[model samples]
Each structure stands twice: as structure tokens, then as C-alpha cells.
Target chain A: MRNLPSSEAGAGPETVDATRRTLLQTGLFGSLLLGAAGATATLSGCTGRTEATAAGYKFLRDADLPFLRALLPGVLGSLLPAAGMERDRLLDDLLHRIDLSGYRLGLPSQKALAQLFDLLNMRLTRRLMAGIGPWEESTPAQVQAFLERWRGSSFAVLNTGYRALIKLVAGSFYGTPAGWAAANYPGPPPGPYQVFNS
Target chain B: MAIDDIYTKGIADGWKVVDASTLKQDQTYEADVAIIGSGAGGGTAAEILSAAGLKVLILEEGPLQTAANFKDMNDARAYGELYQEGAGRATSDGAVAILQGRSVGGTTTVNWTSSFRTPPQTLQYWADTFALKGGGEADMAPWFAQMEERLGISPWAVPPNANNDALKRGADKLGWAAHVIPRNVRGCWNLGYCGLGCPTNAKQSMLVTTIPSALKNGAQLVHHVSVRKLQFSGGKVSGLSAEALGPDGVKRSGVNITVKARHYVLAGGAINNPALLLRSNAPDPHQRIGKRTCIHPVNLSLAMMPEKVEGYYGAPQSVYSDEYQWKHGATGPAGYKIEVAPMQPLLGSVIFGRYGEELKTGMAQLPNMQSMLALLRDGFDEQSPGGSVEIDDSGAPVLHYDFSDYMWDGFRRAYLSMAELQFAAGAKQVMPLHLDSRPYESWEQTRTAIGGLQYRKQRVPVFTAHLMGGCAMGEDEKLTVVDSDARFRHADNLSIIDGSIFPTSIGANPQLSIYGFACKNATKLAGVLKA
Candidate 1:
């Protein structure tokens, strides 16, 4: 929350780049594996290769990595073209895009990573909104409107980034212990409150 | 007489009460005590002093609004009825924000009715910090008890309204502590329109309570009379000069009224009190009259649920958490009170906004979604006492406030906490109330995403309904406009008994505390007059 106060100052370009790299290296591969595992498991109701990979990553020593791994694949797969690149090829591509060298920088890494994930979620959500249907079926007018809304000054882009991040965090943390602990969440488990449950 | 008798007896007392809009100030008037502004502080003081057989005259700038005339929570009508400028005006920047009341009853007519006595610890701090005397909690206990009884303060025992129930559900789910908020109301129908002048007259605003009592005790009130300046003679307030504005918003010719009084009380609230002093040039070289304005900045966080919440159909706010109120080493401003406030569809639509087909899907599920707000009370900082309310060359009240860095910091923290809480409490998605901002899915993402929020040089939203501490009280004339007794240091015959005299922001709804302090000051002033 201390960083939350001064968060108004625009992050330096170097900091943003470093933060991005750290998120890719630490968070990207695990999140992808988890997403693929959750998707394929929900698809066939069977523990497939994706699920085995996800389970292996989930047992990792670092807390955030497994959660992110489980979260990313589900979120990204939900955003992916249903019948396109092979799951392994997509995961590999995402890993290649990851930049992890910035993790060594002594800045508040957790907060910076949280911010990076939020920005990524915002970008992805905008894509999701714009691509309500398959890209081929989407109208030029709809695409233009989405781009117009998202494009502009750095602040406007950052705002979209933040919203996406919050959505991703909420989605990943939905039923998980880590997410619940982070939120200090107190609500009916997966349902609306019953006034007189007794 | 019973409380209800005062209104009936006021009409019989020959006080010549008239609708504020219909009132045209006479060229002249004379009274023993001329009070400006007729809200909680002024109205209470007028009642106490008049009951003691003092001839009292009360002048209020805004038109009186009765229950019959109050709009039923319609933002537009209510804005015209109670707001200073129809609610679209901005601070120094073009950021749209909310200010206090402008009608005869002042801000009380639009308050949430949350009532609390001044905390004893805060009083002790005030006494020690400002060298104020007789302000300890023990000295103020009787006043608090009296005011609470008069206002009918009670913990809401009625089943939590739907909105409040939602908050409770969320809190229960999160294992956080929450409780029913005590308010100053009797037989409230839970119509959820307190912010727009409750049409049922159930809320204990001064319009229904103090004004009638003061009138019954021989106090005369003239509304729509805009006081321009205080006439000072040898450092004592001799009279006040004012003009009556026509319906066209222009000054009516020859309707100028000069009121002569042995004593004067300035109760024009935080913003206008300092403005009036600056306009009158009442001999202050301290430059501290309008310098330390505090508005507990608040923001809303809306959550999308799977069932119908119909948030606007119940109470405006019902429950809150005090767990974070004194957190963080007890130095920084405490965390926010997560409050349940239902809003009308128009406002809700704006809040939910365009969020892809998911938002459209959410809108279709509107009945299931509920919203709660977080009001953060930031610490007092003297960045800009807010530009003093000054008459432009054309003589209309112009108010300008600069956003301080500390206040902005508080707002950021509040927004982050609210989003995190909503997501935790089973919200499918959390949307910020910012005009162009998108919804967040996770708390971690929200923190990072919000860190990128830049202070727009052009347009941004800064909202505030809590305005306090403009004409602060202190022992030194150089630091504040009023002394410990609420007496103006420069003018022996003048005093300020309102939120304007708050030494610092009290970090809560101020109505009850304002009334308590007003009663305390009035009691002291009564003794001084008799002596």
C-alpha cells in the first residue's frame, strides 16, 4: 500500500522493461502449463499430458509461480483461437517471449510483477472484447472502435493495462487458497450469501 | 413542550416565517443576535440563545426546502434544490467533484444521518495540540448526550437493508468484522434517498428540527438573503450587509438588507465561512482563514454478481468496518470504511459502463450485482486551504480547490483496497468508478494496473461531499480564525459555531460532532452574555 500511494508516478521505461522480463521468466511458463491443463482437463474430464505438466509445476517451491502457471493457461487458452497452433508450440512461443533478467534488480519485485500481470490482463481483455467473435467474423467497424478506445496517450493505455491485470488476478485467485489469503476474502464459497443459512 | 410542539408553536409565535425563495430582504433590520447560516451549528445556537430570552435573527443564503418540496432522490432536481452549483462544477482543475449543501438547511438536508460523538481521544489531542480549554470529553459528555437524544441517534436494529446485507455477506465470507452503523433517524422507511433530501422528513435534518425550535423561541429567520460582508466598528461586528438574488440569479435592486446586531455568529460552514471573512476583510493578516480545507475523499467499487441485487432500492449506507480505522502505526490516516450505498440505474449504468460482451452480459445480470463504497478520511495537510470563496468582479461566489499530493495518495490507496475487497468477496469482476477506466479481474493486477494511473493534466474525477476545517479554532490568532470558545479573535462580538471551527478533520461524518461543539459554544456564549 505504501507503493500504492506513489504508484501515480509513471514507472520508468527501464523499470517497466525489467518488470516485464521478470514476469515472463518467473510467471509465464507455469501459467501457460496450468491454463492448458485446466482447459484439457475440463474438456475431456481426464488427466491428460497438460494436467500432468500442470501438477508438476504446482508442486514447485515458489508460491506465486505455480499459481501463475495454473492461472495463465486457463486465461490465455480462453483467449486463444480454438483450433490454431499446437499447445506445445504455443507454450514454447510464450516462453521465448519471456524476459527474466530483470528479476535480479533489487526493486519491490512482487509488486512490480503484480503490476505487470495486471497490465497484460488489461491488454488481453481488450483483445477479448474486440474479438468477441473469431477474428475473421469480427467486423472492421468493431475492431476500429476497440482500437480507438484502447489507443491514445500512455495513461489511457496504462488504465486498460491495470483493469486487465485486476481481472486476471481475480480469475486466478477465484477458488485458490493463495488468492483467498491475498484478498483477505470473506464471502460465501462460490455462491451468493444466504441471509438465514441455518 | 414536546419536540413536535415546537413546529406548531413556531407558526403561532408571530415570527413571520416565509419560503426562502419568496423572501425579499428588507432594507434594514435590528436584532440582539444576528446568526448567519441556519444548519446544525447555527440552528442549535439560535435555539439555545433564543430559549434564554435573547432576541435572535437568523439569515440563511439558500432557499428553505420542506419535505413536500424535496425531490424524491432525483439527482437533477436534488442538485437544483440543495447543491451549490447543480453538481457539475469542478475544483481548480476541471475534474468534476461534489461539494456541500446550498439550501436553507445547508448540508444537513443531504447528509447520510450517521451520528457519532466526538471521540474523547481526539478531543484530548485537540486540547493539547491547539491549547484549547474546556474541550475534554468529560466537559463534552453532557452535550453529546443531549444532542444524540435530540437527534434520536440509534443503532439500526432493523434487518440490514439489502445493500447492507450484501456488505455483511461479503464481510462474513471474508471473515472481516462489520457492524450496523448508528444514524440520526426515527422511523426511517429505508427509501435510500438520504443524499437527495429525504422526502419523508424522517431524517433529522435542521430543517425539521432546530429551525422550528429556534422559531418557537422567538428567533426570526430570513432566507435567500446572501450576506456579502460584516460591518466592523473598532474591531467589533456592528452589522452585516447582504443582497437578495432574484429568481433570475441576479441581484434585486433596493433589496439590500443591513442587519444590526449586538452579537454575530458565522456558521456558513467550511467553504463559505472563510470566503465571507475574506470578502468582508475582517482584519486578518494571518492568511490562515481559508488555508486548511479537508474533504474526506471517497470512491466507489462495484462488483458483478450472479443474482439480482437491486442495490438502489434500500438504504444509502448501512454497515461499516472500523478495523482499519487506526491501522499503520497510528500515524498515517486510517484506512477506509467499506460502506454499502445503492445507486439509481442511471448512476449504476455509468458505473458499470462498456466492458465488452462480458459487461453486456453483466448488465443483463444487473439484478444479481451489488455495489459498496469505500470512504477514506485523509489526514489534514495545508497545501491549499482551497482557494477562498471569493466574489468575482461580477460578485458571484467562485470556489477553487487544488488537489494536494497527499490527498491523491489517499485516493489511490482507497481504490486499490476497494477492488481487492470486492474481488475477494466473490465479485466476478471489479469495475473502478473512474470515467474511462476498465474493470479488473484480480487484486494483484489491479495494484499494478492502478499504479499506472497518471494524473491527467486535463480531465479527471475528484469527488467530495465532506468539506471541513476552513475557519479552524486555535488559541493563536495567527493560526486560526476562532479561539477555543468559538469566538472570533479579532471581533469581540462575533463567533463561528460550525464545521468551520473544527481544528482538524475528525475523520468521520461531522454532523453529530458539529452539533455537540455548537451546543458547547452556545452554552459558553450564553453565560458570557448574561455576565
Candidate 2:
């Protein structure tokens, strides 16, 4: 029920700094398994912007897109089409929906997600936390291993991150009609009622 | 076959409905009564007050979507347009996912239509524990009956949907008490789209019922206007300031609106209601503005049935088991009510909580998936003190909810019961919807696994569609924010006629409880205002 102005959608760099500063102050940065000194030294230089990029997503930046592109295939598995225009279109639609889904969430949820996105978007934190290099250069095996590691991790934060990522991707994918055939859902059943489009 | 869009037709017929998003200039509205939301409580109050000849104004932050918008029957569209935070509202820590509606009808718009009266046990507990007055079974029966008739609530006449039938069959085999659930509907198509908003307008939701009735009674309706704060002086509300939302319905549109009313009603339900009060810095000498909030914390288990369940095609919930809901005394241990959820592919996938090939494989069996949910009755014991509503730096509501060991105990028991029930219903495989859980082939295996399974927050999935009580109601000012009449203890000429006033979680789907309570309280308020 938090009503932020539309301008807040592109939270810009200040939010990222605040999120990082809070994480440092709370010692949660160390909980990410990073040494406090190393995290402060490295993360201070990581001025990653959270604003939506020129690629036209409302919440996800350009840096976030490639990361999602690599992760989606690993998460969707054979549910997604095997490399075709159809697969590209489906992924594009899911990416857009995911953006809206994240964008519409309350400030707290958006902030927490932004923190996760920031961590993944920066290369140093990405390497330290996820053990993967550039998302584009990362192999599917690397992405799968990372997801599995997070999912099976005993740390609550990592588990929470895994739930957030998987639910967002899987929920957005399965919610659309393009993802239904894999699950054998034939849309809403035809009944005695007529659908009047607005 | 064509269901007329009640809102379009009503607006065309000269109903004073305004979409704030379309406004070009700021506006000031004066009314005899101004209601802050248009959900079950607000809808009920609006019709009653307006029909009593008072000029009522209803304001909603959500859009004025109707049956027309619901015709798509698409989960994506529905969640994006109709739900709070796109149905992504969760606890502050994200351990529990919440499903509350944000449309004109509020949750009644998308609720599964399982209408149950305030369970007598809950009413009695509120009276004895909270010193709540005039909410006993006999005192509320007439109000319940009146709303039941008004909303066309009755036990479903059709055969149970396969998803619900499994619950009945399992309970029957186990000698547990099971019964057909009463629903608030008329001419229901059994299309299993209640959660997406009823396309046929046959579910008798407030959007299609009391709202239109209130409009016809000359009530003014405004949508897409977000209330920012309630201004008050000398223990009386002065006026409320609001901002108009753009077509996107998420951000402000730069047009300010002021509402001045003789009486103000807070019917925004649990979370938002407390948030509004907190944002306004409302007078709370007892510091009880956002305490004792109760969500009927739900956990679920998915069963892969041998036959074609097709859980997506029929009524979402038509049968329920109360075998464990009130087995023990209210304060002794956590109890739960068992019901089934429709297995729409999107919802199913999210609940399945798997990835890659396992998720793909599980969803491929969607038609055969029978999911049962256990709603733990919270807020009746010291162990389940319930959560609190706190505002973030942006003044947005953040629910601080954490499960106690007692609740985990309940979750463990509920998982075992659900798995056992599924096996009894002839499920080929059953899996608790937990991150660590895998499907088991028999009750014996499921029992052993569930007993040993980790009961932590991230390990076990938790959810809640029923949000109740933050500005709790009772006679004691020390323990309650509102009185038995639903009037704010600190504010004169202000009343809370929503689920936020519940002294405890009503051990059932609370739409009917809200309707009944609002009808009684609003009627009393109307008499006072008229006099």
C-alpha cells in the first residue's frame, strides 16, 4: 500500500547506494560471506545504477537483462522452446511481464529485489557471490550450478533469493498462454458465459 | 450468455462515477459520509448509508474494472490489474506471500466465494477475552441472515468439483467431518475463475451488488484515487487529502483531491487501514493502531491424482473439512481448516517451487494435480499473537510477521494430515509444498518425511489470502483500537467498518463476517447521523 510517485520506478543510483550502505551498516554484507573490509573496499567502487535502461523495461536495467537471459533458460529448462524466434519472443514477453511484476511491488519488496539485482549486476559481487563471470560469457552449466547452489544453500538469505528468482521467473512464465502448453492447460474452459472485451 | 457490464451501464445511466485517472484538475468533494475503500466492508456500508438517504462517497485506489475487464479470464491480466502489488504482496521478509485484491470490490472481487458466518467459537472468544460486546452468535444471526439473503449466499447446489471432492472423499474415508461450503453466488457458471474476478457477474461480489446498489441510491463513486492522510483536529476528522492515480494505477497523477465529510469510514481492510492511520499520525494513546494483526497463515500440499482432476475447470472450493479447526480449545493449540485450491497453471507453478526440469515435469501433470490448503487459525492464543503493521520510510505498510514454534508445530501437523488425506483419496503421489519436500508414494512415507522435515520459514511455503485485525475492536481501550460499535476510540465521527476491526481472526473466510459486521455498525452509525 505504499504509493511512490512514478519517478520512483527508476530509483537511480541513490537507492543503490542507500541499499548498499544499509547492508554494510547491518553487517549483512559480511553475511553475504564477504569480509567487511573487502566488501567496503570493493563495493564502494561498484556504483551500479538500477534505473531501467534504454532497452525499455520499467524496472530491469540493461545489465539485468543479460543476466536474466542466461538464467531463464536454466530455470525454464525444456519448458522453453529450443532456440528459435518463438523462444526469443516468449522470453521477451516474460521479461516484460517480470519487469511489470517487480515494478508494481511495494517499496520494501522493490528495494530488497533491487539489492539482489545490484549484487548480480556488478561483476565483482557477481564473481564473489555467484562464482560466475560476465553473464554473457557464463555457460549454461555455470548458471545451473549457481541456481542449484542457492536453492540448496542452508543460508536463509540465499534461499530467499532463490525463491524470489524462481517464483518471479516461473510464475511470470506459467501465467502467460505461451507457457501453458508445456503444462497441458487449455486456457479457461468455454462455458455458458460470453467474454466481452473492453 | 452476455453478462451486461454493470459499471458501464450504470455510468451510462447517469450514475455519478468518476475515474480519477481521467481528471484534468484537482477537485474537492463534500459528502455526508465518506468511505475510504470499496471492498466488502465499504461496499456494505455504502449501500446501507446511501439507501438511508445520506449522501455517501466511496473512494478506491484501484481501477473501476468490472465484468468486462474480467472477461479475459487470464491470470496475468487479473493479477496485474486486480490484486494488491500484482498479487506479490508479502511479509516484510518475504517469507509469506499474501493475496489481497485491490479492485473496487476489494477481495470480494477475487475471493473464492467461500462465505462462512463468524464462527461462534471466534465470536465467543472475542467476547470473553477482548471484552467485545454484542457480537455473540444470537446477536449477529439476524445481520448474517440479512447479508446472506442480500448476497445470495447458499450452500453450493451443484456436485463438488473434483478438487474439492477429493477432500470430501478423503475425509469420508477417514471418518472426519466434512461438508459442502456455502458460497456467495447466484447462477454461478462453475467456471473456476473466481480468483480472477467473476466473468459472468454471477458470484454476487460487491462490485456487482452493493456498489451498484449504492450508486443507484445516488452515492458518488471515485476510483483510482489514493488517500494519503486523514487530517483531524480536537479528536475529530477534518478532511482527507488524496492524490489521483494515472491510468497505470500505481503512481500519482499530480492531481490532488480533498474530501470533506461529516463522518469518515475506514474500510480499507487490515494492512492499508492501519497504514492509513499510521500515516496520518492518528491519536493512539494506547499505542494500538497496528497491533494484533492476524492472517490465517496457510500451508498446502499437492497431490498427483490417478484420475483427471482438471482442478482448473470447476468451482475452486466447494467442500471443506473442519475436523481440526476447533478440535482443541481456542488458546490450547493452533488448529486449521482444510480446503482445496484450484490448480491454475500459473499458481500451480509458483506453489510447486521447483526449477528447470523438475518444474517442467511437475507442471506437465497440471490436470492431475489436486492441491489442498490448511488455513491455521491464528490470534487466539499467546503462542499465535499474530503480526503487526508497520510503515516503511516511504509511509507504505510493511507487515512484520514471524512464525512461532507453536505455528511450526501446527504446520507440521497440517502437512501430515493433508498428505494422509491425499493418500486416502487415492493419490498416486503427494508432496508438501515445501522447498525441501519431495513427492512420497504412500501415507507411511509422507508421515515419516514430514515429521523429519525442517519447519523453518524458507523451507516450508506459507501464504495467506485472509487478512484480519490490526485496529482490533473491543470495549477495552487498553487492548482495542475500536469499540464494539466499530468506532475509533480516539476519534469521534470516525468508524472502522472492515476486517481491521476484528478482535481475532474469524476462523473462516471472513467476507461474510465483514458484511455482517459492517451492516450492523453502519446501520447504527446511520441512525446516529440521522438523529
Candidate 3:
């Protein structure tokens, strides 16, 4: 339901400042590496993106920043227990995933991407943590057991999460510069199908 | 392939099937009798009347959903398909009680598939108390027989599935009598998805049986058209004005249509029918249009067993205990039939969510538990709060309900009975569906556990899918919405032949009774049309 302004508005200093502020507050810089590792674990659980068309693949490039921005806070909250070590590792890995300098120039293009990552992170945490007993009592071996049980199964923990993420990205892209032209979604609405040839 | 296959293929080839909400008002027409609903009563009436050569039109407010469309019959689609917002609404106080069904076939689409004729004693009670002439068991026997045959109602020939077995085991352990309740399903696969809309078309919902037959017999059904008011002239119904919901999900101009009919049948179920009458402002000196709403409110008890029961893999509801139904010296209220109900993981999560963090932990043990519902046949009392269904400025029916203390006490008793049964059945933990109370670990703890509970004060949520009585049928106009013959007291051609015409709530699933009454009423309507 959230409609973002077009890519042309990405140059606004207000938007840049806000994004930077959110990143700093949430310590996204530190959590980036861990988030990537979590995302990898999540992606492993997913069956490959069957719904995404070849053209749809391009939307993924512009989707990273917003996806990460939204995802970092939740990831940090989940990884808080080991934030000091996990934060440094996560940030390093995220930087490796994309060129931070290029993203800084085209932050709006990366907004959807950020949102998708964030969604992935949230979903991973939900599946991994849900119904598992209190974290305090969960030993390292138990956590490993939980990961093995959920992470590699064909009934991947991340399928629903990825579906939701794709839907969000689709919504955002249609509302932004990538708009209808990027996805080749029809416009002005086609007429109803005629039952008869006439 | 098969005859039904050819028939379905032919129908699918010919008709213009539109989702009710997508229906436009540009296509308006007239009919001999306009039946406003497509559930048990309305569907049967449409079939009979249409076959009898009367032009019948069925108006349903909900979309026409089929078995193939029910793959995702979870909470989201439930809101769209079922009524009372998926489960019946409780009083604002959240005492657990609910109304049922809103889709094409009404509650029949989401019902438990159990079928029972109105017991002979119940008919006698109606005759003795209300003076409802010509409605004795004998008068209704033929109709009931026909309906039963059409629905293929019969007791389960196969062994009760694992869930039912668990319930039977629990009942036997407690020395309670149990039986396989008859269901109207043919070729049931024990696919534990009845409440979510049966996928196989095995469950004989009106959508599959009566509505399809009615349509085949030339009964025109207009879905998503909500009848706002009964058009009246000279103290009789002339037609009705209905506003169709626009594609944008709001009422729009050019979407309102008026249809003229010589006869009108209000089968909008118990709740909406009365609200429609009230909104129409049709003469009702009786002031009894929306009075005497009776919901057979059910209570749920979760029995934590030692084995991984996998409760959601079988029929949604099958086993029952009618032993306590008419208990000895039962002066206050009739007892209930304890039936095992299938609750899938998602739904189980919602029910478990009510138990708070304890249930969160219990979810880890989900595969180990079995659950069942206690369905009570409650008596109608003047003290029970009556709800009025009136139209808002936008012409949508708005419902107002207040749960009575008397019903709450019965609910409490039902819950206790279930918990005791579960304990006797050797459950390690027994959880009452009471939101305000903690789950009891033992039967000894039940009294203390439930005693301090304030269902009304805390507003615990109760859901009922079986809502009956709004436009009740009786002998006199001052006492009911329609006369014994299902004719509206004031309107010449308008009648009611659904659950809305039940003078009082029957203690069982009302599908068979509704069908029987509709068939009988359709015969009467046919007699009038023939004349």
C-alpha cells in the first residue's frame, strides 16, 4: 500500500539523510555481513524463484537498498545477543554483495532491493525462532539442530518469505520509476474477454 | 465420461459465471418468485419451484465459490466465504459465540456435514407451545425423507477415522455413550477439510446439489446483489431495490437495480432477513422480525494426548454422543452432542494463540494433541439478548448482538464437560477454549481453574456458524415474520423458507430441517402458482 516517489526523486537530500540516519541507528553497517549469511541460509531454503520472469530479474538490482534498509533493524534485533562479533561480519559481507558507493548515488533504485532483503531476514527469523523453546535454554547444539532441521529441507523455511518479498517488490516497482515499463505489466486496463468470436 | 461430468462440462460451457461482487446492475430482470439466498432452504425452494414451471430467481449476497476454489480456505478466504466474519461474532464482551456462513450456499458450504431431521418431539413441542398447525412430524416426514435421499444422508459405513476414534476412546474411558452421527456426504475421503470448504464436492452443500439443480431447471441466480428494501405498494410486495457492490468494493451509482416480481421469498438466513425487513420498513406490527435469535453455541476442549494424533488428517466432524442430548430431568436446557472436530495447523495456531505463551509452547506438541467441540442444544429464553440486522446509510447490513448470561452459563457447563471427558480419556493436559482462564493440568483443578473465570467480564471470543431465527414462521403475524405456510404476514406474494423461518432453534445441525421446510413451503407456493 505504500507508494514511493519515482526514481527521479532519489536525488533528494532529505531522503538520503533519512536513509543514512536509519542505517546508523539500526547499526546496519555492522549487521550487513550477518544479514547476508542469514539471507544465504534463507535463500538455500527457497525453491528457485519460479515466478520471476527474466525481465523481472532486473528489478532485483534496484530492490536491494530499500530491502536491506527495512531488513537490518529486524536482523540486528535477532542477532543482538552476538551483535559485537556478528555485526562486523554482517556489514563486511553486505559490502561484498554490492558496491556501497554506487548505491549511495542511486539509493532510490536500491530501495525495493533493501525491502526484499529485510523481508527475507524477518521471515528467516520467524521460521527459525517460531515454536522453538526459549533461546536462553537452547544450547549451541540445539540451535545447530534447529538450523539443520529447517534450513536444508525441501519444505524450505524461506519459500513463503520470498513470495511475500516478491509481491512487495512488485508493488513498489509498479509505484516507482521501474513502473509498468520495467515489468511489461499492461496498462489502461484491457477490455473483458469476449465469450463469442464476434 | 460420467453423466455428472458431462452435465458439469455442459453447464461450465454455457453459463456466464461472475463473482457476485463483480455482477453489474445493468442486467436487471423479473421473475415469478425471487428467493433471496442460495443455501439449504432457498436452494431447495428454487429447485422445486423452477421444476414446477415457476420462474424462480435466487439472490445470494456472497460469491459463488466451488470446490476447486477452496484450496486456500484459511482465515483470509474464510472472511470472504463464511459469515459472521468467518465465525459468528460474540457480544462486544467477547463471550464465545458466533454466527455462520455468508457465501453462495450460505453456511452449508462451511458446515460440519452432519444432518438431522427435526426430532418428532421438537415438532410436538412446536405444535403444543406455538400452535403451529400442520407442522407435525407426520406432515414433514415425506419432505424430510426426500431431502435425506437427495443429500444421501447416512451413518458412516466405514470405521471412524483416527480423530473420531480418539473421541470415542475418550468418551468410553469416561463411560459416556457415543455414536457415528449421520452426515449428508457421499464418497467422503476423510479429508478433514469440511469447515474450510470441501474440495471434492462430496459434501452435499446447496452449491453442489440444490443450486446446480435449480440452475439446470432454469432458476436464475444473481450473486453479490444485496436486497436493500422490499418494494411495497397497497400493503403488498411489488418488487425489491438492490444496490450491487462496485468493483472498487464500495457501492456505486448505475449499480443499483430494481426488479419486479409477483412473489418474493426472503431466504437471507436468520440474521440478514430480519435486518432486510427492518430496513425495508415493510409493515410489521409484530415487532418480532429480529426477535428470538438462537445460536447453538459450541464449546471447544483440547485434549493433549500422548500420541501424535495428527487430528487434521480425517473428516472435519464425524463422531458424536447424543446420550446427554435429552438427559433425564433436563428441565433447564438440553445437553449437547460431543463431536470430534478437525482443526488444521493454522486454525489450531489461532485456537492455541488464545492460550497465550503456554499455547505457544504447546504448538511444539501440536502433533501430539487431539481436539473436539461440544455442540449444545440451547433453549430460547427472553433474557437472551436479541440482535437486530439493520442497514447502514450505505445500505449494507450492520449486525448488533449482545450475549446473555444464561447462554454463558451453558457454555461454561459445556466446557467443563469436555474437560472432564478429556481427563477421563487419559489426556496429560486439558485446555479449555476459554480465553480468560489458564489450561487445567488435571480434572481436580478444573473447578478452581474455571471458577474464577469471567467470560463476560473479560470478553472471551466465541464463534458460531449456525445462526437461526429472524424472520420466524408462526401462526399469527404478531408473533412471527411469516405465517405457517411461509407467507409474509403483510405481503401477498412474499414468503420466507429458510433458517430465518424457524420459530425457535433446533438442537442439531439445521440443514435437513431447513431443506424439509423449504421443500414443503415450495409445494405450497407451487399450489398457489398453479391456481
Error of 1 at A84 (Å): 48
Candidate 2: tens digits of C-alpha lDDT, residues B230-319: 997998999999988899988778889999999999999899999999989999998998899999999999999999999988889999
How many steric overlaps does candidate 2 have? Answer: 0
Q: Model 2 misses residue A2 by how many Å?
A: 18
Worst 10 residues of 3 chain B by lDDT: B1-10
Residue pairs with clashing backbones, model 2? none
lDDT of 2 at B462: 91
User: Model 2: per-residue lDDT, tens digit, A1-198?
Assistant: 122223222233444556555445443323563343237447576444534343676677777788899888878878888888999999999899888998788766776776677677676668777878899987767888898888788887777888889999999999878678888998877544334442
Q: If the candidates were sorted by their lDDT against the true structure, best first, what order would they fall in?
A: 2, 3, 1
State candidate 2's DockQ: 0.53
> Judged by DockQ cut-offs, is candidate 3 incorrect, acceptable, medium or high?
incorrect
Q: Any idea what lDDT model 1 has?
A: 0.59
lDDT against the true structure, each candidate: 0.59, 0.87, 0.59
In candidate 1, what are the lDDT values of residues B1-531, reduced to their tens digit? Answer: 112323345567576564434554466778888889988888888888888788888988776666655533454356544766433333432232455786767888887777777656557656766677778889889998898898888888777766677677767777877888778888886766677776666888888888877887878888767787898789898788877655422224336678898899998887778768877778777877776666655666677765556665556667876555556532365446677665553334334433334333444454556676666554433442343444332223334455566556666666776676676666777766664466677777777766777544222345567677777787867677788899998889999999888766666678888999999899889878867
Q: Which ranges of candidate 2 are over 4 A from the true structure? A: A1-14, A21-44, A50-52, A191-198
Please give the RMSD to the true structure for each candidate, in Å: 18.6, 2.5, 14.8
Give one digit per residue, the lDDT tens place, for model 3 in B502-526. 7666767788889889989998898
